[model samples]
Target: MSAPDTNTETQHPAHKTPLAGIAIGVGVAVALLIALMVWLAYNGNEPRDASDGAAAVQIETPTGGSLTITGTASD
Candidate 1:
């Protein structure tokens, strides 16, 4: 009896994974987050000057006690 011939050609092509694209996207996101964090860190530590037009409020309670608060109006 004769042996059957085996097929040497592939039926389907191999599909490539988008590893490089995913890596680049992750890198960009991380860089943007780091930059935002750095910007916030620098801006948040700035000192507020008293000459910057700060406002104060005082409230008198029914028992003749007073509450004093001071800061900018936006605070």
Candidate 2:
């Protein structure tokens, strides 16, 4: 006489998909974009060179005064 079956049956594939490549690509792109934005923001926020000081701001005094710009670049 034969014994009853005890093994289980599976309907789907056993191995799961690994989309690490796509994830890595997206991460790299995001990092690059963030770095670029940071670079642009830093450059935009500060003056071009040590010679150029703070940005020119419009000001109207009680009797109107001439603007004198100065730069104190330590390093």
Candidate 3:
């Protein structure tokens, strides 16, 4: 017989590369990104409410000695 052809058709199935590795790498990256976004959403909600209802002054009141009380109230 003459020399056989050496084209792509002569390649073996065992020599072929797999597509599974590329798909798994992409799937893992997407899962991590979604988890990080959820954490940031819960963190920003609390500080906004605390700043709106803050107090500037505290007072001390004494009992029936109701004879003397001195202070100025301001708004």
Candidate 4:
């Protein structure tokens, strides 16, 4: 018996795993989501022009009467 073969080298498969692809796709998706959130946060906070519509505030008196103060956007 020729000295029992002692080769210990590990051989990797030629085909690549899908994990890398999956990770890349997930990263891109997360990046897009972050960008969208940032865009919404930025755009959502913009000041609105009073000319767009009327603004009203309502207050209730202790006597059960309600008073509404209304003003045009130009105010």
What TM value does model 2 have? 0.39
Please write out the lDDT profile of model 1 over residues 1-75, one tens digit for every residue: 764753435422222246666888999999999999999988895456656677667899999999988887667
- How would the candidate models be sorted by lDDT, starting from the highest? 4, 1, 2, 3
**Residues 1-75 of candidate 4: C-alpha lDDT, one tens digit per residue:** 665754545323322457677889999999999999999988894347545466777999999999998887467
Q: Whose TM-score is higher: candidate 2's or candidate 4's?
A: 4
How accurate locally, in lDDT, is each candidate? Answer: 0.74, 0.63, 0.56, 0.74
TM-score per candidate: 0.43, 0.39, 0.38, 0.43
> Per-candidate RMSD vs. true structure?
10.5, 9.4, 14.0, 9.0
Tell me the tens digit of each residue's lDDT in model 3 across 1-75: 865765656565534444456677778888878888888876754434334454234355575342433333332
Could you tell me the TM-score of candidate 4?
Answer: 0.43
List candidate 4 segments past 4 Å from native: 1-16, 45-48, 51-75
TM-score of 3: 0.38
RMSD of 1: 10.5
